[model samples]
Target: MSAPSDAKHPPPLEHAASWYAASANAAPARPALSADVSCDVCVVGAGFTGLSSALHLAEKGLDVVVLEAARVGYGASGRNGGQIVNSYSRDMDVIEDKYGAETARALGDMAFEGNRIIRERIASYDIECDLRERNLFAACNARQLQGLKAHQALWRRYGHDQLELLEGKAYRREIGSDRYTGALVDHSGGHLHPLNLVLGEAAAFESLGGKIFEHSPVVSLVHGQTVTVKTADGRVHADRVVMAGNAYMSGVMPALEGKSMPCGTQIIATEPLGEDLARTLLPNDIAVEDCNYLLDYYRLTRDNRLIYGGGVNYGNAGPANIEAVIRPKMLKTFPQLKDVRVDYAWSGNFLMTLNRLPQFGVINDNVYYAQGYSGHGVTCTHLAGRLISEVMTGRDERFDAFAGLPHLPFPGGRLLRVPLSAMGAWYYETRDKLGI
Candidate 1:
């Protein structure tokens, strides 16, 4: 399979105009590929996954070259809610029920590995990404609250003890909102400045002798004893290739197109609400995401701005006015914020698999790919990079565990998958409304 090269294809270049970009730390624009290069490993996509893979491989003294379609973290990695929620989009109970106890156990152990990797990178490299250490899953109705209870019990059985359940006024204390009936807090989970974190990781990778090329989209990938990845003006011949491009890969691999559909999620940042107001809105300053099918996730920025995100477009097209679509949800969650001014609004696409599980596997003998993190890519992507590196280093047990998970394609073909998924989501959304 080859990357798309057409006039309509967006060029791999600048970062999106997001709140993250406005306050991003200084990082020079990397040069695009202009000449052929050879490496032990070639990584496509410089988001969290690619950067993590490159950093890990370079740490092992491997020759690594990463080719990015755009600037580092130009996709969902840079534009997500930045919540470090452990586990997949689907809960462990669902996985256990569908796959079995052993499979669920293996995945459960890996669920928190990504969070550990992120914290280690931040401390080891001293990357300043406003790293925090708490996240809450708020429940709006009794059914959702019951699910949280079951979720906490399930995690406890898996030896996870950092969970704390809050109810009534205690829930209100944790999150300064009257909307939640109860909340489950994960002390191990947290949030960070996602774009800055990715950029810092890229720098760390480069410092370890890993090469990175920005604005170099993979036009074709030729698999063989030594895979060849070609860009518009250059090529990379490597012992192995890793396809880390999620939703933004276009048609790079025709086989991967149907396994997941790109879904658009939008976010809006409110103007600085002052320290007092911010404190009042989020008393503990921890990230929060509801338990609904179409969830609303949010957190307070370092500058005291409310970074609220929700509203998914299953068709992959962004709303005409992102602020308009998100503002109502924010107002519903925190009525006092109705008068707050929106400072920035943006949208990005995440790969949503049919079963809501990430897709990870090898394309051939040496070409590997991992995608379809749903909306949980921030942490899972880091884990993916580690898994890929481990697999390359002759450690395939953990990698195989993820690779064994089944990933089904959408019911309809690519042309109809978007609308079909949208209709399915509507049904679930209706069920959530009915509290069923």
Candidate 2:
């Protein structure tokens, strides 16, 4: 572990536009990386991590250039469930059971800080993304209910006493659904407009004079004292580079492409239900997630639309008709939504490592990367960016904790991991049916 330094971490520059492009706070697009450029750092992927690294480093007056294949926020950072959740995918108790209480405490603390990282950014940066402070951790079954109970107790041991375990009417009141038997109300976690958040940070990064190139996909990198980042139309000479592409950097970096598998998550936005029905649907406007591996995450959009996310698939192929695939899932959760029209339906990929914990670290000290937040990218990516910035300068303590967690690459390599995962998913679904 090294001390946090003041170096900028830049990736390959990209040039283009996106949905975020349509709604970015103040996007003064920069010219493409047309010629060989020299910079203190180059960042790849204008998503949370890359934009954030650029922001922090440029704040320190470093010459930073960010590269993205598409426009910023085109990847999982913009498409996630907007759940600013704590704890890694393995859960706190699993960490405690396998690693011990001390390590579990560190894990919980990091996750808790992941929430704080977001809150601090919203306030400090004045980001307006329908920010809220309600998070309902739900259990779909009694068995899951017990696990949440244990999870609450373990988190409490870490001094998070404010976490409230709600059941019965309390759970019903916290969320509008009786389908969930119990829930943990994490007042600290919340929901937000993710694309806006990423775009806002990009604005802040530019404010500090960071250079950005859109539609600039990094085709190759030559590593040495100074990293040579080559994009199709341009090149960058920098002391350090950061890969923050997450699920979108397909084939850009050979070593990272297969490390994390991408799974498609679908969402259905109901036509405006009005305050009356929206209040009945989710009175508290709390973001919710179930305990099932394939979970349903939903929240009321600022305009009173039920933004329901569900049906995760382990293939690159998106559901041809997202409305058709998600409407049934929504109706199952809220039969009252039978008459509700799904105004918008979309699906996006979320990368998940086999270990279930997020992957963050310096593939090389001068070259850092962060990904595999599972479905918890909103807040985790913020933390990832911060830590990667720290690693870029010299700090390495916090980054090491996450990097220390073991991550196993999918077996059968590139050719068959998807099929294997799909088969395993079917088995889990079958078990769900058999009550196993």
Pick the lDDT winner: 1
* Sliding window of 10 residues with minimal summed lDDT for model 2: 13-22
Residue pairs in candidate 1 whose N, alpha carbon or C atoms collide under 3 angstroms: none
Runs in model 2 deviating more than 4 A are 1-26, 99-103, 433-436
TM-scores for every predicted model: 0.97, 0.91
Taken over the whole model, the C-alpha lDDT of each candidate is 0.90, 0.77
* Native-to-model Cα distance after best TM-score fit, residue 192 in candidate 1, in Å: 0.6
**Per-residue lDDT value at 383 in model 2:** 79
Model 2, span 60-169: residue lDDT tens:
77899999876777777776667778766777777778767776776677777667877776788788777887788887777777877888887787777768887756
| C-alpha lDDT (0 to 100) for residue 266 of candidate 1 | 92
lDDT of 1: 0.90
Clash count for each candidate, listed in order shown: 0, 22
lDDT of 1 by residue, 1-436 (tens): 6444577355446787889999899998888888999999999999998899999999998999999988899999998898998888887889999999998999998888898999999999889998888999999888999999999998888778899999666888777888888999999999999999999999999888889999888999988999999988899999999999899898779888878888999999999999998988889999999988899999999999999999689856789999989999999889999889999999999999888999989977799999899999988999999999999999999999889998887888888887887887899888888888
